[model samples]
Target: MQSELILKKDVDLHHSQDPYRVQNADEIDEDQSIERQLRFVLNRLTPENFQKLVINLINLPLNTQERLNTAVNIIYQNALNEELYSHLYAQACKLMSQIKVPFEHVSSKFISFLSILLKKCEKEFDTDYHKDKYYEYLVKEAEFVTDEQKRKQLLDQANEQLEKAKQNYIGNVSFLAELYNMDLLDDAILHEGIKRLFEKQEKDEENLECLCKLLTRVGPKFDNYKNKEKIDDYFEHLRDIYEKRFSISARIRFMILNLIELRENNWTPRHESGPKRIEEIRNQVLAEREERELRFAQTVPQTQIEFMVADGRRYSLFYGYAHHILDQLKYREDFDRVLGYILKVDPDRHSELFEALICISMDKSDQQRDLIGEFFYQNLKSKVFKLDQFKMGLRKVLLKALESYMKGYKFPKKLSQILANLIRLDFLDISFLKDAFEPVKRDQLCARIMAKTLKLAAEQIGCQNVSDIFELSGLDFNYFFENFENEVDRRDFFKEMRIEWVSTIHEHQRQSVELIQSFKEKLEVIFRETGEEPLAVLDRIEPEFHKEETKTKEFIRALSVVFFEKVLHHKRIDSDKFKKMENILVNFVKEHLDLQLEMLYSVQVLAFHMKYETNFLPVSFMLLYSDEIVERKAFFKWMNNPRGKGHGIAQVFLSSFFEHISRPQTEK
Candidate 1:
């Protein structure tokens, strides 16, 4: 009775137009057997319902080989009928094999069924070949007999059968590839099938089409397998066929050439959408990012999403609304409302928000720049923003200013004004100037713009304070001086701006002199009170010179002068103390540039105190020369045009110093 039911359903499936269509209620109620249930589940398979279908199939009563055979037959027949769901069918077969119970041998069964199905398809291909020949003969005979209607009918039947045969062949090849992709079939089976098609293609163009279709479906996978040499040989054969087969249709020839190129590119199609194409795109993106980083040295790639979650809602404040508000900001009075809106939207990205505000204000009017400056000052003063955050924002702003300058924009006077305002507010200092300008030196235009901005800033804050800032910051004036090729432009610029470069130097010199005097007075007092060694006295008063580089150099020169005086007056020297002080001076000169002139001045001071006692000058000169404390070239250059020629002892000391250096060490 069960066999009869199965036979009845098979007949129904064979006759139905849409074999896998959902059965009606009357048809479904006729059978509740395991075979019927399997048929029902297989017909309804989908990606979303795949797991549920797997569970449903497992729950069916397939406790015997006979029932399992029936279920496998149903799955195979459904897959053959509906060719588009071949991958899903393959996946179902894999899942059933993993069950390890009654379905453990299900894979072997499916493979055997697939083998039989492939043979059946090949037999159909042969049958179609014979039918086409028969039709060709009938058409020719009818044409010879002048039967136009019969010839037309024969041609239509031939075309219809050929198309149907082509679709069935494509579907069969696709199913084989799908099973291979699911690892349910061996490479040997696939290789044999390809070999058979290649041989048949030598005679039949339809076979050639089938061969190309089969290869296109599974070529990349098969080439990547252990049979790469064999695949390569096959492609070589395909190339020869493509070149020599003149009777091949244009369409088939193009397919053959494309397949050859695809294999040559490691199975990566150039214009196709696949994993290899996606990977190539990803690599190109990374390379572009690296180039951008190299071009814009000051900018870093930011990957995090600029959004914040608040009250169960997402607000992309940095990218969307915050920038709009900041850009539209005009008057100072609107600062509070804008700030309120920004804080409400997202406060976590305040640094980025502030940076965006500074960048926007760069191209704005003077009034808007002033508004931003005032906005920053108020927030800074109210302690609503951290100093480090402000510094970070300003650093990024300087980079933006540089980018604008590179594009031939004029120097940003408004940005300079903002910086001056911050300096006056004591919220920013000169050290920030060094930090901001140091990284941009590789770009000369950006460096020059920075110098011009600082010059304009000096205009706002007054030259005296600017001079003091430069002196305290220890920023290299060469950054400013090198901007001009000749001295006249520098002098004219300074004169027109009432920025007395000479006076700034003199003022710093005068400050250094006063500072030296204070140190001398402190040393005298300490020595008088404790009768301590002069080195010990100096050590007690050694300030935190690390805070400033200029002061540190001045302190070292002061120590040199004081020690030389002590050595002259006492008619003796403390070797340990003198060596310690010399080490300090030598290390400082080594670490700094443009200090050779200063060391020369210190040597002159020692000479003046010594007067005609030239014996001690030789040791100091040799130490300076031998240790390379002062550069040797600068030392010789300075000796020829010695300073302080008004003093009689100056000429005498320099003459003797030259003789001492020119003489050999043994003679000394």
Candidate 2:
């Protein structure tokens, strides 16, 4: 079965193998290129024609002919798939010693097959040729990987290579570009690369482009970056070098991203340049969307409405641009616009979509975020027809918000406080009391809601576990202060509100009640003498003694810190006008000595010193600190009585204070 190997005008087989061939396979003579020659054989891939091509490839001598080498490369690239290329690579390896073709050009032809060897080469890249090829193949294949760990491993190895190259790396741009494109969790390599990028004195456009790509990948993953401080520092560096390095388009895009990073950090763009470029980015990005105004009108736009609603059709476009809309809405708190957007969107959309969007948009750790969510919940109770539909969105948003807490996310202290206020203000519904998700948060929420109701009277608002005012015998000055306005109610309201809080034989309760009444009586006279409001307009934030606004009435108000420790912790009533008030205190006790009113005033004095939280000497000439007046022993003895907590707590507090004040002022 020997066929004559006639030279084909279209195909180029070596004359020895060319000596035997089939007739129809050798027809075309127009093309001269080697790639075209191989493509011709690609067209006639019958079993017999395939046999001839393989036999020729096996029999032909490997030589330095560029045309022949190129034809092999083309065949490898065009017809030899990864499997066949792998099979043929053994032969190519043998032929490489004899052929003069550039290996990179030929190696690239079987790139997918060649990539399998890169991991081995990267591990022991002792030779320059192997290191170069390892980087070459890694750059080509990195785009196809999506596994976080695998990508991380590859980046770690590549960064190691870059480290070996030190400050002057020719392939740095290529290696960094590939690393930038990969999605991974380990940020070590990335953080290091970005640091070195800024540290280098001179940078070209390529370096700048690579940096932008890295930043874009890192920007949205704000929740994932454990070290938020580094993220902030990176943005600060970017802002500093922006005008000098980045182009106008790059600046626009970067500033917009920077603003988002700011929002995630519970902040807004602080710099003037940030705001200006944000305006430019807003206009430019929106203008591009505006180009398709007719398409949006033709049918509902496919674009998802998000924090930035730029199209003007579906989105209200808060502040007329999408630039800093998210953070601005957060800062200004335009809840109506948020509600309006929800109302205007497709009524048929699943409610969770809007719910997730609104919740994720907020910095849940920020207290201000609670106020916005509170606004949504409070408005849900309205009788208005328009607000009725918001029930689902409102409910879903709250559940989603609570779900975060269930996942072990802690609310900030401020947020925890605001939650109590909102719940107390009737901002939540009771039906959610049964969501068995986070019992702790549920109990906390319910406890707060009930506390507002139990605040006035001693009855349980709804929950049995929540404390009732009656249980504490109305000895709670806080509850009594807000609820029992008159002295009779102070003395008598507990028996009427909840009898369980009362004990007829508890004489300790009797004297404590008497003290509270006496303090209130004295406080009223002090209030009258000082007038209702102070005439002086002192800066409320400054320490009372440091203030220059000295008015007689204001000094008395300053003195109110005694009973209202929680209210006026820092106030000092040391003005000359307060001397008359001290005389009143001395004379009042003289008048009420038969009633034994001295203990009540001593207890009141202890309350003020307690507010400072320091064990140091009291800063003002307050009564409790005066050693000449031995009221400390009296207060300690009264605390031992059943009216207050006994167990040497008063002795411990005074001892701690005296010990602290005894130290050197500098040490204290």
Candidate 3:
């Protein structure tokens, strides 16, 4: 009866409906039965039972070597479906390898398994081929389907299968890593697998991701192996791929970066601790305990805190904390939080904090300087710190900067930006400007700081304000220029100051001022060389109108004023010269239709300003209208809605001018 039961169990295993079962169980041979039994045992493998399961596998009917080969293949094929148990499968193989088998060892069988897996990965990583096959199958299957929705369903099914294939490929690569980790397979097999992956011509993001996972798993082991140099070369190749391969997705690139960082940190993760040995874990615990003790020692008693403050040790504490805060500051966005910490710790020690901030700002980049300035401005506005503290800090920092400059360290321009911010925030009085220049004659370093400070200050405050401050301080500009060592520096300083003066005007007028200056230079050259009347010289110097219509009109209006002045001085408004000038002006207006109204308005301005000098308004109107330079419609438009309402041109002159143009053709 027991023999019948054993036979019944074998028959049940043979006739079972499992996919790995033979199609015809009745014709199952003895070897097939042994293979089926092996599969059944491996299917139930767990970490606790893996060793016993390896014994059962060894005690099979087949020879020892055949049993090892058959067990390795079954375990590998089962692991592909049970990815979470891959390490268990590897351990089962390792146990079998240690059993002192007669014919062949399980390690050799694992190498065979790895070779099979690498080939499978090569095929699986060829996603293009699988993708093409999927589309081809879809086309063939949906060829006769009339409905679009049905065809789409078939296509979706194919896509699902393709995705499943890709996941299976990744699972196989991970299994290889597990086998390598368990020491069942050597580094050469793992290296071959990685080499095959890298040598593949079409490495999609998924394939590269598989490579990253493989390296992430077994990479650290390779570092200590004999092939460390080869592993380094592989890493170098990965870096090359990351930089040059733009087609890789950002997510995959990030994974590659993480893998590289993992290797760089000696296989330790950045944010989390990796698996640690017993000694390492013990060391970590001891270190943490020591850190807790250090924190306890760092705590100051309330009475001691008061004593420290009374004894002036608070300066040391504040300076240390301030320097630490500056060192850790990475971005401007952290300024508010940093200030809050400072306030919470020692709010009354504003002077020390300010001095520390200024010193660091001078030593760092311009952005750091700007951030510090913004910090000061915000605290001042909130009344968090006294304005007097900031001023005192600035004086101290400036002295230090002067000393550094005297030592041949080139002065940092960013210091001036801090000064500018202080002046703009009213934390520093304009008198500070006068005091900054007090030692200009006595010291070259002071002169350099004063020049840079004044230039930046003028840019922040108005140039007029700076000039007024200088005048009130009794500081002479010529004296400042004479103190400079070279002529070029003096000239550059003068030119920059002049530019700052022009920059202080309204943006609209600023452009007009610059164009007016440029036109004056050209006109002077013409006047000096040709010696013609104002209108003739105006005709000679061609006006390069601005592309913007408003600016061009401004230029025309300004030119009209200068030319009118010249006409008055030379008194050369004869008919022939006036006609020539009129023709030139008319051509300018014609080239820009938008400027026609501007020309008419310019004439009105000239008439308004020189009303007492001559009655050329009517003559100018007739010339413009007769030349068709200013369209009659445009002239009417200007008369209805005129610009420059503050010019105070008389209404009667305009009306009479209009009446004169309205007269009949033969009215003489």
- Best-fitting candidate, measured by lDDT? 3
Model 2 Cα lDDT, one tens digit per residue, 1-668: 22445443356646685476654635743334344545565454432233234433433333324444554454433322322223233333232322332245553132222232222222322233224655556655665789878877777776665454432232333233332333312467567666765564243333444455446434545324485788778666666666464543565446546655665655533553323434345545655664465345446554543333433543323222222233334422366665565454455552444344444434332333444445544554453213323435435544544556532333323233322322321212323222321233333333232233343222212221122112222223233233334656544644433432333323432444544445455545545555433332122222333334222223333334332332232453333444323433342233332222233434434432343244322333234334222243344444334233211223334544544433444664
lDDT of 1 by residue, 163-217 (tens): 6556665666666677777776789978887888788886778777777766776
Q: Which stretches in model 2 have alpha-carbon errors above 4 Å?
A: 1-199, 202-311, 315-371, 374-511, 515-576, 583-668
The 10-residue segment of model 2 with minimum total lDDT is: 460-469
Clashing residue pairs in candidate 1 are none
Q: Which stretches of model 3 miss by more than 4 angstroms?
A: 1-36, 62-73, 96-139, 270-668
Residue 577 lDDT in model 2? 40
**What does candidate 3's lDDT look like per residue over 1-668, in tens digits?**
98989876735335556557437877987777899888888877764344335656756664455655565567667777787788777666555554433335433232333344345545644445455566578767877788999988987887777776667778788887877887767877778878877876254667788899889878777678588888888889889988999888899889899999999899987775445544345445644654464355458564443212311223234444454455444444577667765665555566666776777556554545655666776677567777666656655666665566522444536566565554441222244444444444455555555556667666554454455444433555555446667777766765754543422323433445666566656655665565645456545655433445323665566555554444443432455655545554554566565678766666665564443235566666666777676777676677656354212233335566666554444652
**Candidates 1 and 2: which is better by lDDT?**
1
Worst 10-residue lDDT window, candidate 3? 306-315
Q: RMSD per prediction, one decimal? A: 32.1, 29.9, 31.7
- List ranges where model 1 is wrong by over 4 Å: 1-85, 96-158, 272-668
Error of 3 at 388 (Å): 84
Model 3: pairs clashing at backbone N, Cα or C within 3 Å: none
| TM-score, candidate number 1 | 0.33
